[model samples]
Target: MTIATDKITYSFAEYLELEETAAYKNEYQDGEIVPMTGGTTDHNKIALNFAAYLKFALKGRKYNIFIGDVKLWIAQYRQATYPDVMLIEGEPIYYETGKTTVTNP
Candidate 1:
């Protein structure tokens, strides 16, 4: 489905095509493409610190920790956005063939 706007509308596939070449990230909300804001220093620090702690705690366990940059697809909300951090107990389930977006946390 394409997003309806005064200027332009883009389908999910089209959004993916644009996203591939975008300098920054864009989130898919319902049908709109929302550009993501850059993270502040404090935000980065907090994300990194939490990820590090989780990694250490889950060392030698069957788990994976992902920080910012990993997209999470929330189908129920028809949205896909990057999360601060993700803790997957096992292999990640992707939203599509690509490894960037994940369907399950």
Candidate 2:
């Protein structure tokens, strides 16, 4: 039950380019790239179920629920994470090269 150990290092510029269209998403942090693992079918089902419930329960609220491939940047730690579920409000953030900074989950 371990993620692959190919903790290859990448510069910020290289990371941005790699993220543009990598087959599977990679999480960037501390000058290292950790290949993301695909979740099981059960994981997908549960996530969808939760998302559906949240959407219905939060109808008319300002919160937005994102399912997958959404970037969460934590600028304080210079890392970026892709989370299973994220709720965000207001203008969205985009990584424009190294122009944008990120943080870990």
Candidate 3:
């Protein structure tokens, strides 16, 4: 289930800080932080299959393939999300020095 707080809104920085220690994945939209729902088994299998295929097809290439766990930071929308699969070619552009958040796909 997705959890959204209506009583209090959080700033982008505050959301990021809270997310670091959050038990579950949280999505930041504008100034609100919402908890993400866990995907079903079928979803996990599909994502894994896709990632495996990409890895095989792009073997020895410069592209990096990430599945489900990496955080994607979208500055224009002020949103942070975890996509099912992401493929980044060449070096990735990070949002912070921690290098845990990526700004480019």
Reference-based lDDT, each prediction = 0.88, 0.71, 0.90
- In candidate 1, stretches whose alpha carbon ends up further than 4 angstroms from where it belongs are 1-9
Candidate 2 lDDT over 1-105, as tens digits, reads: 887876567786687788877888888787887788889999999988988898888888876777766777766676777777766664455555442332322
User: What is the TM-score (0 to 1) of candidate 3?
Assistant: 0.88
User: Per-residue lDDT of 2-105 in model 1, one digit per residue for the tens?
Assistant: 98769566677777788889999999887889999999999999999999999999999999899988888888988888899999989899877998888888
Worst 10 residues of 1 by lDDT: 7-16
Per candidate, the number of residue pairs that clash is 0, 3, 0
The top-ranked prediction according to TM-score is 3
**Candidate 2 weakest lDDT stretch, 10 residues:** 96-105
The model with the greater TM-score, 2 or 3, is 3
- RMSD (CA, Å), candidate 3 to true, equals 4.1
Candidate 3's C-alpha lDDT?
Answer: 0.90
- Runs of candidate 3 exceeding 4 Å displacement: 1-7
Residue 11, candidate 2: alpha-carbon lDDT: 81
Q: What is the C-alpha RMSD of each candidate to the true structure, in Å?
A: 4.6, 5.6, 4.1
Q: Select the stronger candidate by lDDT from 1 and 3.
A: 3
